[model samples]
Target: MAEWINVKDIADGAKFYAGAAIRIMPTPCGLEEGNFIPENGLVYLISDNASDKSYFNCVCLSAGEEGNVICRLERKGNYVLGSEIKRMFESELQEAFISKSIEIAVI
Candidate 1:
């Protein structure tokens, strides 16, 4: 099984925009280590399990602090209808992370 971290745990300076596609990364070493990698087509949702595949369309209710990020994962499809996942970091969906940063270019 893969180790998971909570968004609230490391959501101090994280940035999240609703309706915008975000990504999530997995912590191979666990939350204590605070290490993560970039994951494609995956977003952190409100859950304890880091490997939860169901909470894919979770939306961020708040923004994060500034500095080194722990993980990075991206939301795959279009969020036209909005995110299915809801809840706060300390409550329901606590397990979430941003593995890495991806650069987007405007065409």
Candidate 2:
């Protein structure tokens, strides 16, 4: 099973690569990472560098790791709608998701 995590929680000060699988919660304005628990349905991917105190730059999740995910992106070659990341500058949006399988360093 996969886990839902808050980027802010795991972002301990390391860089999250693009295409990382993650679960996120839907908001009135947009979607946001929910928590730091593993769950199924990898429905989001990190689209850009996300710091511990920053918002996510992600898209809908897909199969495989970063390499595989990148291939999927190349095949699709189009922007995913309704999957845009929000609250980039807000310091109150406490939501993030990351896979426990992936190794992360604590700072």
- Please report the candidate that would top lDDT against the real structure: 2
Residue 98 CA error for candidate 2 (Å)? 2.3
lDDT of candidates 1 onward, in order? 0.33, 0.39
Writing each residue's lDDT as its tens digit, candidate 2 over 1-107 gives 55545655543333444545555434333324553223433355555433422333445433453222211221112222112222241234233455533333456
Model 1 regions lying over 4 Å from their true place: 1-6, 9-18, 30-104
Q: Write one digit per residue (lDDT tens) for candidate 1, span 26-70.
A: 444433454333332244322122464423334332234222322
> lDDT score, residue 40, model 2?
37
- What's the lDDT of the predicted structure labeled candidate 1? 0.33
RMSD (CA, Å), each prediction:
13.2, 12.1
